[model samples]
Target: MSTLIAGTPLAGRVAVVTGASSGIGEATAERFAELGAKVALLARRKDRLEDVAERITSKGGIALALPTDVTDRAAVRAAAERISVELGNVDLVFANAGVQLISEIGDLKTEDWDAQIDLNIKGVMNTIQAFVGSLEAAGTDGRPADLITTSSIAATRVLEKFQVYSGTKAYISHITRLLRTELGRKNVRVSTVEPGMVNTELPDHVTDPDASKLMADLIHQIDVLQSADVAETVSFVAALPKHVNLTELTILPTAQII
Candidate 1:
């Protein structure tokens, strides 16, 4: 009922954010809180989530730290139920849990591939499955319910050593688009956000030396995208008018050609 300029557009709204321990997910949760949303932070790190919740609560925003592994369907479901009971029906769900382990196809690490598939793909599915019902149930209360996933530019670009990671992201991007078609009729908006070279722990998780060096060089050469940049994109999409759904957004640094 409030405008983004006049006051908190998300005031009185309930938002659930996965991967809230750090990076873009954490930034987005904090931004949502600043906009007066009651935020539920979900992640595997209880300590980190607690720290984030403390920061939000100290600033007069409501926050709940729920340590959850997105890869676990039952746990994700339980966390969603808890948030619904404690805060209210979720108006926004940020399915942002992911991992980036890069290696060339010839030297592929099967374990790493499995880990990426589980978190990057299955995790996204679990997050959406857990909260979509709530979003569907929440009719247009002046603003449409939103579900946004943190996809990546790798979905479309063929970054060396990122075959598995890119594959997972591509799946997410396609899935989000399909969901929009089904959920739009119910006033539930689904969006996929693809960001390029964000300064986050994602690159830190890279194990391949060549890939690491390539990423490091890119970061050093170009003014890299920050977590807040992606977070701002998430907030903007969430704050848009009910009829205006930004179904897909691709954010890249000016210098980033890929």
Candidate 2:
């Protein structure tokens, strides 16, 4: 079986990335392709996924764009099944679909809370449910399989006005750790990548005017980390030796804390 090394550790592997239309998810998909993995990009926007797939194909990488919404269990399952049929097997799964909404507990809208929970929490569960079997099969065939989920520093640090968003991230961190315990014996690695203040469309999902202003201010005050930084970290974790599992990684700019 081939292994991902520093240069191109993902060579000959198959990776399925959720929320691949933009931001960290898209960046991670591109990086996986660059490392020689056959990548399947799954997202709701067919046009955006196709564009990314075209770019990968143009660069001599193998890619398939599957229009999907991670929040939909049936759709996510179908996408995984399609990848298994077409790409052979999934060696890695990135459960990266997430949203950010900032609202004070007193002022929080129920709909905003539900949206965040559905995407950030339920979506990760859906991705894992859809791909764990394929990932296990990949390992049985002597291929190392990995499950990487995107969490956030919010999971650890709770600030004012981010109650629901922080809670959702905390759930991700908890569930990934539990999965690591359960899957370790199966030789299927599980890892969570926690990033701080990344520059992405995550903040754009915020609808509250006051909350958005506060978040924008905080983002501008700090040198917000880029999606590429987190994507590189994802690659590094996925490239580890079969026996080596990086259970958790938290990355933040040197100048930022909490």
Candidate 3:
């Protein structure tokens, strides 16, 4: 994310990214660090999180990996406390952790639905609760602060077998808007990035045969957005002037009709 970007615009800032184990989360964290922001990585995949932190450090960047289950509010809070002591108050946060489980409505994949709800919706709430205080403080002190969430084009696109996933993303997009009512007053920028069909490990987790085939066909047919592409867009959102807030951003490949 940094190599493509021009200067150290984010220097001296502290940024946190959830779902840092892979894909968008990993790309965003690395980019922020490269831009000179102290980074904290949060994810359930401890090994991968550590690996990501090592990659940032190898590049002479500062990063702290804190393995966390974002669904658990308590764990999120604990990690926030540690970040405060070690990295100072975080000024930018990318609540990017989420899961995609595609299944038919008649199939009633309760487990899959629960997993998406827990990690996508509940996890976002936990992250916001854990760090909003610091963001508020930063804003009150006339500092730059941002709270950004990773939503999806599914929130508005009507895709078959993506009912539950779409609902979860819709919640995220709308919630970001609502959060701005208060956080914006504090001078903290709150926004959401909704990306279409990024080529990532997310699709590999699809269990339904028809849904999997549909996603496969789409990827094979057209150019899909890469995780790094989304990361760059997100980094742009964060690096924007504090007075400007791109409240909702939708990123998609030029060839992607949907």
In lDDT terms, which candidate is top? Answer: 3
Report the lDDT tens digits of candidate 3 across residue range 34-77.
88899999999999999999999999999999999999999999
lDDT of 2 at 112: 85
Best by the TM-score measure: 3
TM-score of 3: 0.97
lDDT of 1 by residue, 1-258 (tens): 122333698887899999999999999999899987999999999999999999999999999999999999999999989998999999899999999998878875999999999999999889988988888887455456999999999999988778999999999999988887799988998899999988888889887999899889889999998888888778999888877889889999889887
Local lDDT at 100 for model 2? 86
lDDT for 229 in candidate 3 is 89
| Candidate number that wins on TM-score, 1 or 3 | 3
Inter-residue clash pairs, candidate 1: none
Regions of candidate 3 where Cα sits further than 4 Å from its true position: 1-4
In Å, residue 245's CA in model 1 sits off its true spot by: 0.5
Model 1 quality (TM-score): 0.95
User: How should the candidates be ordered by TM-score, best one leading?
Assistant: 3, 1, 2
Residue 75 of model 2 has an lDDT of 89
Instruction: Indicate the worst ten consecutive residues by lDDT in candidate 3.
Output: 1-10
